[model samples]
Target: MFRFFLLSIVCLITIPGFAQFPESKPEDEPFLDIGVALRFNYNLSTWKEDQLERGGDFGFDIFRINVLAAYKGIKLNAEYRHYAEGFGGGMLKQGWFQYDFSEASQIQVGLNQVPFGIQQYNSNNWFFNMTYYVGFEDDHDMGIKYIRDTGRWKWQAAYYKSAEDLVFSAAEGSPDRYSYDILGRNKENNQLDFKVVRRLGDSLAHELGISTQGGLLYNLDTEENGTRYAGAIHYEYKTGHSLWNIKLQAMFYRINPEYAPGNNLNFVEMGAYGANYNVANKGEIYTAGIAYHIPLETRLLQGITLYNNYGYYNKRVSGFENSHMNVLGALWTAGPMYIYTDAAFGYNQPWLGPEWENAFTAGTPGDTDWHMRFNINLGYYF
Candidate 1:
């Protein structure tokens, strides 16, 4: 099934070396590393008049701190971000503690990444794929996870007791977060997530996997529990040591909320990044992305990754419209400084347009025009 899809879409791009903590040697003792990063951004969006009049707007974006430590058999990873006040105040990306049961198995607790989708991410762009808006990609929840790795097979199983919510969710001020999650009257709870990946090829050039998550949607209105489920199959490939990366995934997701009588059943409240919005109860999303890395030898320049990613959402409900997002972007790296320039185009996407309401759920049918945001982000890590 996937063999044909992989062959047909073996187009472009690949994952780059993500920031990783140094591993402790068998004979070594405990070690700790802390790093800091400051990122700035310039944006040209059609929706912002102040930005358009000036040809764009430039300012500080975020400052983040990372901590990684390992001792004996225990390990730790965490990051904290301080964004501009306009983008909410501060947020914790993830903070998890793990205990290794040999190299093949381990367990983690605290706010952890959900074991779903193509590992941690798909596209290298700043906005990620459209699935991010629907509370799927790069999602983290207060949970516990068990992981096992052996041969060509890898597995992850997690139980998220509840979606990440600090303070009051439905209160006046919503949560400012790094990942989208269910918020408002209906909350997410007792989610069970499991994923299995198999690496194929002599050099582990190909990866195939499936992921599924199911949980209860607890409604504050009715004081009853509904249900939600998401399932997806993904395929990824690389040319061992080459500069290209390819990833494709198809996902089906749905939410059945038992709201109080007369409440809106078609949409659920989803929030992230200091905001709240409605998301369709059911939808199917498809994502495909490609990128290529070009390494340059120079004093001021190092490497650049040129890539394109596309995502589509087809809702299974009426009075709702479909959505599409396509991002053409590049990532440039020079020492501790990294730059991301992207021309992101979208149809009915909230972040991309004048449609500020129901961009993910109801989708403005009148807003048929396409929107674009040209964004450049520069960050220096130390």
Candidate 2:
């Protein structure tokens, strides 16, 4: 059934309109662009206890294809992804339609990018930051969004039915990659996000935003609500063959869940198969990162970029030590392909430690705390 449904969408997206209803100028008739990407990676983790796997391992990462089209003032975007699990049972990562009102304003509807945090984030590494793990980054949802960009100030606002819903809904308790509000008898009540960005100068900018969400979890017999506020500052400079970018951001988020005394457990962090998810509270996350790009003259080397990111999460729960993560990485690009390598180390305090899958899960309070992992990603985009 899933395969048939996926094929149906392919047919709808690929087939041309059989009936013409209107005409447009040459520049507005229609245009389509498509691209594909294949990614492979190698991973090594110090927390892995498997003796036979102490060396390392490599495997196929993911395959993705995207389509973009525009006609008159309407635009369409969609993406399909296939992963190792379930083999060919593909998934629709994103699909949306946008309407342009002017050169500086537009509105999008459907499954669109959620305007929160620093959209793409400031990390050069692929794993990104912890906020991403908690649903504040690279997340999209069914919504309507309005975006405006003048010269000095930019504005974005969105209204979503829930944090998520898909063309194909997952079975109950099925593991998902992105986090969402847990619904009781229905989807998350509703979510809204608003942000404003100001250009400080030619090379600097700043942004401030807020997000509000509420829902219920009948299975857990709880009601959940959260509000998040964040701010970010960014700067970029380019000279000769060198380019540099720096970014810093901080966020404070709080979740309130209705609960009975002594029964205060609610899932968070998009529960994994064998992980705990009882920790949720007011917390602040701070991240700072810098990247330097170097131009290359060699035929096989297009450019090189070096970056490092530092992130700290402070939980509001008493006696919970702060979590810290640091990453340093580099990317080498050649034509349509790029190779990325990075080393990441972090500690997840006691309260949140057990929610993870690494050595942190085994550590007791007051233990020397840290875990490390190295990763390499190679991908081609065409």
Candidate 3:
């Protein structure tokens, strides 16, 4: 399917007559923006012994290249990234084309971000909220979406072939990078998602919306249906460079497996904080965060922002304990470079990483019940 999508995109770009887009202005040149981001990171504490053994303490975060081109009302965008290890040598993070039907409406196709959680997370933390690990925020999939804004309201809806392909592919002996599947009980299935938002007022505005997903997931030879529901609210107060924002969201899911011999349980892999922690029959997830941006008057910096996020995972299955995760971070924007530093802490958060869980459960009196990470990320964006 990935190959087919690539081929279709190539055909669209290379087709003799179709390549000519209608010009919005005959005399104006097409607009293009190219950007590159280099990340340098340091891990003060990995919170896992195995990560240290694997030399994961410090390294380059990623080498990213981005391109955006627009002619008339037609636009093309792509982002490619190179990781240090595991996953794959590199992958396409986003590649999509957008055609505007009007000033406030557009159609997008290709691999793009799924519109589930906050439009663009308002968190100043580098890692974003925990919902990200569970595929709620910043998750991208190959699909087509229609989006529109009508001054006071916004609408988005999409259908995806699968959650995503290459990003979920396993590396070496480890499991897939992400544990949960939006497809639910079927190995391959389609998912429909819709979101509608209404905004109130201008300054000190209120934004509320709801979104849902229905699909299938697979287990062995049998497939099952799975469904999810979620709702979100965001509040913002902005006056000049000083801004305050808050976000709240909740999600619940259930899986119904087909009755197959030897298949007794409907399973869903729950991932947290970038780790596949446990499997459950059903679960509820709650997430919230607040951010404040303080404009700076210094000669070298544009702003200093602070943010905090909290997440709770409640598993309904027995023998599974709930987990909590949080992050307090700050960002300093100086010219084209941004410096981010944060302290992440988690409790009973097996999603912190498998190796960390093993160390915590090893019964050593010295093992800490909570995990902590002191992280710093330096990104130069152009």
Index of the highest-lDDT prediction: 1
Minimum summed lDDT over a 10-residue window in model 3 is located at: 8-17
Q: RMSD of each candidate? A: 7.5, 7.5, 8.0
Question: What's the TM-score of each model vs. the native?
Answer: 0.92, 0.78, 0.78
lDDT score of residue 7 within candidate 1: 11
The C-alpha stretches of model 1 lying farther than 4 A from their native spots are 1-19, 26-28, 168-173
Residue pair clashes in candidate 1:
12-290, 12-291, 13-245, 13-290, 13-291, 13-292, 14-245
Residue 122 in candidate 2, Cα distance off native in Å: 3.1
In Å, residue 34's CA in model 2 sits off its true spot by 0.8
Candidate numbers sorted by lDDT from highest down: 1, 3, 2
- Give the candidate number with the greatest TM-score: 1
Model 3: which residue pairs collide? 183-216, 184-217, 185-216, 185-217, 185-218, 186-216, 186-217, 186-218
Which residue runs does candidate 3 get wrong by more than 4 Å?
1-28, 49-56, 166-188, 223-242, 257-260, 263-266, 270-279, 351-368
Candidate 2, residues 1-382, lDDT tens digits: the string is 1111111112110011111112333444565656678888887877665722667888887788877766667888887777667332355667789877877898999888777766545465666766655556667777899999886777788887755443234233333323333332223336777776665544444343334333332223433443333333333232233376666677766655454456533323343212223334456778777788877889999788888878877776655556778878888877767788888877773222223532122224476467677889887766
Angstrom error at residue 73, model 1:
1.7
